[model samples]
Target chain A: MYGWIWRHLPGNVYVRILISTVLVVGVVFLLFQYVFPWAEPMLPFNDVTVDGAAEPLGTPRAGGAA
Target chain B: MALRALVRTLSETCITIGLVIVLFVVYLLYWTGLRAAHASDDEIARLHKQWAQGPTGSAPAHEGTAGGTRDSGHDGGTTGGADELAGDGGAGDADSTAPGHRAGESFAVMYIPRFGGDWSKPVLENTATATLRRGLGHYTGTADPGDKGNFAVAGHRRTYGDPFKDFPRLRPGDPVVVNDGDTWYTYTITARPYRTLPGDTGVLKAVPEPVDEAATPFRRSGRYLTLTTCDPEWGSSHRLIAWGRLDATRPTAEGKPDALTREGR
Candidate 1:
């Protein structure tokens, strides 16, 4: 996948390096700012509330009280 | 030659994946804390600015009526003398009419001297992940500060500034003081941190009765404060709760409460 991206980049070797650096930074920014925050609630690390949907001990029980 | 090239590519991919996983962990543990610190600072600053401007600038007409009724109700409390003095000075007017906090809006600043003299966090309106990232979150539908019910709040134990990172250190008789621009509400810890499953919402009730009995069980409805957080430091499989009761309330005009000023507690 990375090889394909490198090969398809439209630039000389130096320019390609610069472009790839920018693209990498952009990808990391998007992942940190959007993807990770959106995905965080799905993970159990930060779950502090005692609500039904976020119970991590086991599969949420049937008719479990919130 | 083909096999060698494929092996090189596969190794490169694996290394990239590993680096990304490491980066994500750093983001979770460090970067989020940085961002949350900035957010919490801004929220607290905003709250202070709003409070300094006084009630006329923000409160609606209907809120005046609400303030009147609330003041009357507070006057009937056992601590009626102070409430009456606050009312007479007109300090309670702005406090009672303080605008109802909207979702994600910060309305209070909490100080846990047990954490440190400088340990303070803005208490926002809701407990959503986004809101908790900024500071401690006031559990919606619970009692307001100084009110006659549980004024519950939740914070992260690990990341996003870890406002309650020292949650387990809280012991009975420690003080958790809150400032809502006009009054300082001091709550005395009634029990050590209680451990329970995430499904036990009873710990946030007006008169809390956690599924696991609290070390100091509350027997009556009264002004209470509950602080909750994820347990095990880095895990969220359980919740740790600390309960407190309103020990005293003084108008901010009266200066810092004794719970905050006394040393060597």
Candidate 2:
């Protein structure tokens, strides 16, 4: 079934490949850059702040009962 | 021909963009780490200066007072007429008294004989990572070194050049020396461990209740020294309290340790 579909394709190999590559890149870029950052609060990285000015990088033990 | 060229160009452009992004992130992380380390070092330096010159409170931004205690004693002590920073060793001169030792002065190189030379340096106070890394903290608020209240100091139990890694091994009378370049204040352990909550002001209240009431400080007759760290000897939950009192402060012309000057100086 794949062989028949391949033979019946409208465009040549390179054009099909280009289209597929662009689609995949667009989806991945959208997910990583826009979607993930917006839904960041739901992610595990939310708790890990990479910002410099945050409290000293201390062991969780540094988190006192206070 | 044009389509092939475009694909190759696009791939090259994407690769360059990805590399630049990666480099930028790396640079950011490196910059942050260096800033933290430098700040920590400055804090350690300031703490040493405080220990050397003593807590003058002469300028803003400097915490603690001269010849006074940091804050309180332990978990639950009353604060009536508490001149916690008073240097009660009977020497009235502010400059000569040890109360509120200077922040960063290398008064004494704390030696945990168990950890050997690599683990020794002047202790510091404050929340600075570099200062705490060196193992000294401001004893909240207490009278100056000579005063009649407990002088408290705190440090971390782990990470960023952990200095208190072996502090748990300090037995009673196992010397804790605070050297002010000219003299050494030796403290001897007197109490067993007690639990203190974080943000609990009572612990800094000048008088700490005797865990066993019999061991109380003879109704405020003797000055106290308290060592605070995160409890459990491994992790921080409550504070692990190590109580001590003025063993002796010895004047040294040479590098003679003050622990040897008890009664002779």
Candidate 3:
């Protein structure tokens, strides 16, 4: 798909490559500085923060309640 | 001529892609590492200055006066609080969660001898990525070191000087020592490092599961030290944790604690 887009771009090979690189980098910079932080709260990166939640020891001893 | 132009376009695209991949490698591994190293160095310098000038045994950043526990025992010397930072061992936890103890502020120093004889990293107040770049960051809302709950911290496992790179090398009973300016809190590694998902906050709790009331810090049976880092060294899909139980606390004035003295462990 990207190759098809590249084939259709105007200008010589070098100019097109330069334009493509610039566009890609710009998008990446925007995502890192703005998009990622904004979306982090909705992500699973920091779900468990404090010492309040628990995981089932699941390895309960005999007669231990689940 | 048409075939030649097509070939030229394809080659140029391939070379551009090669360059992009190389640059991305440099950014991910070397660039971030270099950036974090500089940030941590500056943070270390700032902490040293604070230790030098800030009043020893200073009040917690949030509340309470120095007078609340100005003499919370551990003051063995009759000459008054002249030699060490605070030199007292009371529940100085009063101000641990104070708002002033925000991210980026270096609050303690983590000493893991396995890293090096002089391996001491600043312990920042929060575990945010920016804060971890500075040094190991304490998890907010957890018990402070020597307190009866979990004194948890997180750090980069691979980048930013790889503070916890040798985490798996710690065996049960290895000492994970922390210095909070005035006192040394020693903890012993409890079990093999545990693995958990990033969302499983259960490991951060005072008790791992079921919230055993009897195992809480209030009952004094729940003291813990947890060190977390991204597992597998190169990804963050999972987390590796080291658990420890508080072993001892000694006033800095008392000189180096047994853990530091037993450095080979």
Candidate 4:
């Protein structure tokens, strides 16, 4: 099935270029705009406080604390 | 058949050119809109009047708060970390004190003297989409300009040419200023260095664990200025975090941002 589909695929340069561009753009949009963004944690990035002497791991996030 | 093919090819070429022209015009419109927004007459007047009254004597420094200036003066190029700035061999001072922010925009330039030369604009989180390549990212989850909680910001350190360029220069006692219209919010550097992952959960936590048993000061709660940039400046590894508290606020209409008020222990 795969061999047959590949053989039948359009060999035209313009068609190939257009299809490739669309695929590349779609992948990028999905990864950067939707997937990566959706996965970012709440307050995805914030400042950290590390105590060197104690060598203890810092505290966790305080969701919406006033 | 050949003639027909030629006509079709010509039509396709025309369409491509037309699309390119359309995109070019749209980009021009976007640029104009940004400039107008930044240079609105009222905004310019307010800044000018404020600067005239302030001790800086000149217009409020464009590099106001986070790390670089927000002024529309320079093309949005920034260096990351102290070494990059220092490596510039003293080239970062070109427009250090100049008015970088245009007029109408709610943005300010941030400059760290220790960061050498490049300055960046810490823009409102909402407006950061267009300005991300220029400087820091304002976290929407955080507090407003002066409300409370951590007013967090993130910027790239390695990629896109290090727009947070001088974030590493930040140390305890340095001033981080944010100018919005007439208000100039100043933040005093506090705490020591901390590290976290790119999406580290610990970075934006509401409050830091107490170092000592002493009671914490609530008055300084909520209001904060956070600086975040790529860690290991050369690599895309963890992030470097710097925290500052609201020390004092002075309007451009008021004289200088009182240096004494920002004096740290």
Candidate 5:
């Protein structure tokens, strides 16, 4: 997927490099600002808390008291 | 031969630039979060130490008692225990004497059992990047803790410990507790955090609803808490809000309140 995109980017080596750099950064900025945060639910993060004193285990969605 | 060698060197330079760009992305997405998390931990530790060293300049954090600040309303100091009357029964004025609640200062420690028993974050004074990067920041213009208004705060939904990452998981009636100078103010989540536009500052109001200034005054009478973070977890187009109402308050000297007691049920 990446290789194909690299070949299609028109320009001499230097211009191609500049264009690729800009494209990569723009895409990354968009992803970081929007795509990544939106994917938080599907991501495996926030499933566990790092409690140093206790046995590390996954916790259920804690909603109720105690 | 020289031209071929020149071409080879140019290709190497291009590869190097690409590598550098990749590294920059990693730093932005991953390293920055790690740094922010560490900074937050440090700030929390500092606040804890400062509070430990300073005197809690109010009435004891005992139940059903307003520690009698000259300006803090003392009408309903009787809302004590697990049944702290929620509708403005005992919430007092924002303790102005506490230096922590001032802009750039770390005021309180927020504990949400629904997030995790060990999950605690420092609540800073302002909403600046430097402040929010450390922990949750109390919106300066909003009500302070235990006040008869919205004690609104903002935090990073995805980074800087992602303190509110599980905010959506918090259901109604869950406890959202804060430890200011002396009291552990326990609030109950009102409902799942609803969404709103980024410009909607009205949700931070005491009533937790939008209002038009041309129609009515911009304030309400209640002890509410508003937690806000970016919406969609990946974008800043909107906001995700979690609203809670103050339910209980206990003096630090008396030990953890009933809401924190996780024994049988």
Candidate 6:
């Protein structure tokens, strides 16, 4: 995939490297600022609340105090 | 030649995928923390500016009444005690002190002595995902600071600046102090961190536990506080809860509460 990108660049090796660096940075920026945040809610790490809609852990009385 | 090209493309695709996955993890672990730290700092600064502007007296009287409607369902007997403490002009002005109840609005600052002397986070009004990213989030429908019911707040245990990173470190008698730009309400942790599942919304109830449970810290709601966070540091399979009871209330003008002072602990 990267090879195709490299081959398609219309520049000398030095300029190609610069363009590649910029592209990489841009892609990372897009992933971090947009893609990852859009994907985070689907992950379990931020589920701090005990909402009824969340998946049950099968232990009906896990809370102990219920 | 075709086979060689196919294998090269497949390997490159795999390498790209791996790099992206690693980068995503980095974003989740460190980049998110960096962003959240800025967001939290801004929120705290914004809250301080709002407080400095003046008291929250101009807030609609009907909105204050509406906010208190939930607490009315609890028995009035215990409510009077908290009300009296909250009624005092300096510390007890719970009704008129909250800035706004709008979702995502930050209304207070919380300090957990156990978390660290420098540890303080703005307490926002709701627990929405985006809201929690800014700072600790107050669960909507719960009691306000120094009020008669459970004043529950939730924070991330790992990412989003890890507001509750040391959640499990909290123990009974630890102090969780809150300032609503008016009063400093100090609550003493009444129990060790209780491990529970995410679906146990009961833990946020006015009375957290059942009446018969010997472990129940609160028999009836007077002035309670609950702090919750994702369990296991890096995962959210479980939740860790710490319950607290309002121990003291003082006007912000009195300076920092004893719980927050260097000599208090």
**Compared to the true structure, candidate 6 yields what TM-score?**
0.83
Q: Could you give candidate 2's per-residue lDDT for residues B184-217 as a string of tens digits?
A: 5566776554555444433433565634455453
lDDT of 3: 0.61
TM-score of each: 0.81, 0.47, 0.66, 0.43, 0.64, 0.83
Of the candidates numbered 5 and 6, which has the greater TM-score value?
A: 6
For model 3, residues A1-66, the per-residue Cα lDDT tens digits are 367778988899999999899978897777545654444333232322222222121111111111
Q: What share of the true interface contacts does candidate 4 keep?
A: 0.00
lDDT of 3 at B130: 59
| Poorly placed runs, candidate 3 (over 4 Å) | A1-66, B56-58, B61-100, B210-220
Error of 5 at A61 (Å): 33
Q: Which candidate comes out best when scored by DockQ?
A: 6
- TM match of model 4 to true structure: 0.43
TM-score of 3: 0.66
Evaluating just chain A, the predictions reach TM-scores of 0.67, 0.48, 0.56, 0.44, 0.55, 0.71
Model 1 Cα shift for residue B75 (angstroms): 14
The best-first sequence of candidates by TM-score reads 6, 1, 3, 5, 2, 4
Error of 6 at B47 (Å): 0.6
Q: What are the per-model DockQ values? A: 0.29, 0.04, 0.07, 0.03, 0.03, 0.34
Better-scoring candidate (TM-score), 1 or 6: 6
In Å, residue A3's CA in model 1 sits off its true spot by 4.6
Give the C-alpha miss distance for residue B103 in model 1, angstroms. Answer: 1.3
Give the per-residue lDDT digits (tens) of candidate 1, residues A1-66: 688899999979999999999999998998898877776666666777766422222222213222
Model 2, runs deviating above 4 Å = A1-65, B1-118, B125-134, B210-219, B258-265
Write the number of the candidate with greater TM-score, choosing between 4 and 6.
6
Pitting candidate 2 against candidate 4, the one with the higher lDDT is: 2
Q: For candidate 3, write residues B1-265 as lDDT tens digits.
A: 9897788788988996786567655554665567667877777787667767764333354112222232223442332443353333444243334444554588778887767777788887765555665678777766666554577887777755677888778778888888766667777887777766665565665655313333222233345788877776765577777788766667665777777887844
The digit string of per-residue lDDT tens for model 6 on B116-219 reads: 88888999876778888889888776767766567889888888888898888888999999988766778899888888777678777777862225557776
| Model 5, docking class | incorrect
Error of 5 at B33 (Å): 3.4
Candidate 5, B2-40: lDDT as tens digits: 897777778877996687567655754675578777877
